[model samples]
Target chain A: METDLFEQTILPHLDAAYNLARWLAGNEHDARDIVQEAALRAFKFFGGFRGGDARAWLLAIVRNTAFTKMRAQPAQDLGPDDLDKIEDTAPQPAQVLERAGNIEAMRAAIAKLPVEFREVIVFREMENFSYKEIAELVNAPIGTVMSRLARARAQLREIILADANLRETRS
Target chain B: MNCEEVRELVHAYADGELDVARSVDFERHIANCESCAAALRNVRALKPAIRGSYYAAPDDLRASVLRFPSSPDGVRQSGGLPAAERRAGSWLLTGLAIAAALILGFFVGDAFLRRSANQNLLAEITDAHVRSLAANHLADVASSDQHTVRPWFEGKIDFAPPVEDLATAGFPLVGGRLEYLRGRPVAALVYQRRKHFVNLFIWPGDHVTEIRDEKPQRGYNIVHWANDGMTYFAVSEISAPELRQFARDFTTALSH
Candidate 1:
């Protein structure tokens, strides 16, 4: 009965689980390994799962599993004061419009972000998670999620502009 | 609200996470403030561009997940064990599961290459469509406006692939990319049909033909035609009739 429920409730979120794992682990091989391990762990702890957001529950497991693997090589979190150092000048709307289609650059920028900022961006922008949900995922207050999102976008804009300028210089 | 407050609230506003009253206040400020409004637009644009990077679980991973260790007997056999013993057994079980998934992946990986080697035109087109969606590679020049998307192909492809916004007909022009098909570079125009994407591949060719019978390849609907010396293939996951409508409307739009 539990196994059936697990399949029905948690299995549908495989794509979401893989996406989070992929972004966190920063590679496909590790992502696959992490997700597989996470899925087995989730199954083992199936008895503890009360009926709630299965995607969130599964994703929380995925995140923990990825972090455990990353414990060996810790990722530095961005400080709140880092925003001051990151120039507040956002990419102009026109420049953003022109570069918006360059998904490669955007991907690179997101990948380069610190894991703390990167996760919030992924949750809010890609997964369309609410601030509350993002806070719950990261175990932070809603204010922290909002501020991290701001910093992430600020850094992303600068990184994309620098990349574009570098390309222009090269070509 | 002051500019500082608006700047702070813009990300929340863009994410639709702000409360109604705060959102209203933010909108009111942006109504009169150009910089604030531009900030809002820039924030909004970031969403879709980031969403484009979403990685769908690979087929093999998905297949392995379906076989995840949740079998009833497996659970029952281990269900009555002591707490410490169960913990040890679970680790053993987890090890077995990983081994099983790895073995499955190897076979699935083999089948994947074999499938790729024998892929036909329709198969290749469907793969390209899937690949575009896989890794934030949907478009080299993403835009909804035909004027913007059309000119982007200049000096890139040899010939102009007729670009038109089908938004009026429910299929909006999403963007364009330079795709290599038939061993040469071709123009791939992407359009949005509801949630699904329609990839229209175009290249210079002398083969003259009308819209052929819809061929469903690897679960994606394929519609192709030759017009005015250009070969076109429209591929999407939308229904056959809907894809036909897209082709007819697209062809009609190009003629004008």
Candidate 2:
């Protein structure tokens, strides 16, 4: 009976769990391991699921698992140079549109965003998660989710446009 | 709403997250202001583009998960021995018992392994197709024009995904999105047959070949194949024969 419940509640969300883990862990191997660990944790704590959005609940566990894994490892040496670069560019509307259809450019831009901003974009734009749901999942208030999503999109646009300009000159 | 207020609410307005009254006000402002309207369109366009780019879980991930003991306590229920006896057994005996179980499982489970792998792939893609529809995110780049939708995948994936308009053959091109299948990025082409939506996931295959199979799961018909260094999986709620026809037409179009 408990096995049936676990299968019904958690197994269906395996893609979502893997997706969140991939984004947070920054690669496939770590993401896979993290997802396995997260699933085990979810199974152990299945009683606490509380009849809500299973995808969001499982994703929260995946997010927490990824965070714990990251904390245990030393941070990458890529410094604040990217953040500094983002502040340097004054966003222009024409630039954003110019880079709009370039999916590769956009993916790279989003990948470079800070984790806080990146997760909001992944949850909102990619996953179609609502603001309130995002707040609850990420343990932030609604207002913070809104602002972070806004900031993430704006920064992503600027970065894509900047990359477009760089390519144009090189060509 | 003034430009400042409109700017603040633009994202919310584009997301359709605003309340009705606020939405009405937002629309009123957008209708009157060209710049704000353009900004809203950009916001709308950017979202689908982002949704088009995502990672799919590995193929075996689901099967491995399915094989995991259902409940946490199931791990303790190993070998049908009483909890006390199992814990009190000598460590060497426990190790030998585990090794024996592992060897037995390997030989006995080997026969079903191939079928399970196929089932897991079918389940994964079907679930992806269903989730795309359920989430109302079936197409990140929603355009009937193959020119517009096909180029949308450029740089998003490592290969150029074949996108064709099969409207002439009774299957119309809907749009496409980037999906991960079996651990790598693939392109998902959304097509429509009557009122039914078809999700065709394509990625680069190892060799040039043609193989087709029609499998039904939970009322959805899935037809998948690999051809000319590209793999395709077409899934929909339409009849299996209709989906097969769609696949044939798609393959013919790609060959040109």
Candidate 3:
């Protein structure tokens, strides 16, 4: 009975959980490990679930698991503190849009965003979660989510433009 | 809204996060402001490109996840992991379990003096309503017939939850599911109001704590009332007046 409930509530979110873990961990092998570990933790904590958004609940577990791994290897990704080190101003909007169409460039730009910014982007764009949902998922205020998403977009534009410039220079 | 305010809010305006009033004001300002209009376009441009980067789980990962609940000790017991990897995984799992236990202990200890006990109770009911909608697991027994839905709850719960088809009143009975609220099994009856879903949770109670005022939380309206030793909490995104009417109609129908 418990297993049936677990499958019904949690299994449907497997891809979502894995996608969040994959982006946060930044590698297929580590993402797989993080997801596996998170699944174990989720099963253990299943009894305490008082009924709410199952996808959000599962993704929260996945985020915690990924953060635990990242904590062990702090150098793996740029943490929130590293946000200031990157340039705040993006390149020209036209330049950014020119490069946005390139799938690989967009993917790489997203992969290069700081963990905090990357998460909001993934939640807002890939998962199609509302800002309110993103705030709850990240345990932050809605204003904070908005600013982080803005900063994430700015940084993504910068990265894509830089890629465009590098490709132009080479050609 | 001025250009400065519009600049700060253009992203939210583009993202559809602004409330209707603010959105109307924002559009009015943006219509005359070229820079603000450009800002909205710039923010909107990233969406389609970013959506293309979504990653799906690999087949092996799906297989492993499917194995998680079936295994007695969960996924850590799944085969094919190196001995050292399994050891490390179990160590991490142990650490997480201990941390979770500590958090749970703290919450249990602080469960008392929860500042207005009724508020917390309503919050739990609200959460269950959201869960029913979010999980798409609205009903364990899907039946529009009141007789079928009423008898379905017989052995699963200790109390008989009042069920009725309110279709004639513009709120049709859909189904009912067994839910756990405050550690007791309760019956959650699903009803449809236009495109909205109303979850009416009923459980046996001795006290008649009639809720005179409706409660609104997280964009959902809730109406709770007690009759004949059964407490009912009906939660939905529908208007409070309509939900209040639902409560009245439900009680009126049950009295017959």
The number of the candidate with the highest TM-score is 2
DockQ of 2: 0.26
Chain A TM-score per model, please list them: 0.89, 0.82, 0.84
Model 2 Cα RMSD, 1 decimal: 7.9
- Candidate 2 docks at the CAPRI level of acceptable
Predict model 3's lDDT versus the native. Answer: 0.75
Q: Please provide, for model 1 over B1-256, each residue's C-alpha lDDT reduced to its tens digit, 9 standing for 90 to 100.
A: 9887888778777776778899889889999988778788677656556766667788798677656453434333423234563455665666576556645565655555444433546776887798788634688778998899888776555578888899999999899887654234478999998889999999887978888745588788898889888888998989988998998999899888
Candidate 2 residue-wise lDDT, B118-210, digit = tens? 686798799889988865778778899999998888766768988899999999988988765643457899998898899999988776545
lDDT of each: 0.75, 0.73, 0.75
After TM-score superposition, what is the CA distance of residue A96 in candidate 1 from its true location, in Å? Answer: 4.8
TM-score of candidate 3 relative to the true fold: 0.55
Work out the TM-score per prediction.
Answer: 0.61, 0.64, 0.55
lDDT of 1 by residue, A1-171 (tens): 344456556656777888898899899988988888788778778889999877789999999888887773334645553234332534474555556545667778889988888788877766656899989999989887777888888878877877778887999
Clashes by residue pair, model 1:
none
Instruction: At residue A4, give the lDDT of candidate 3.
Output: 46
**Residue-wise C-alpha lDDT for candidate 3, range A46-77, written one tens digit per residue:** 99888988878889888988887677433444
Q: Which candidate tops DockQ? A: 1
How well docked is model 1, in DockQ terms? 0.36
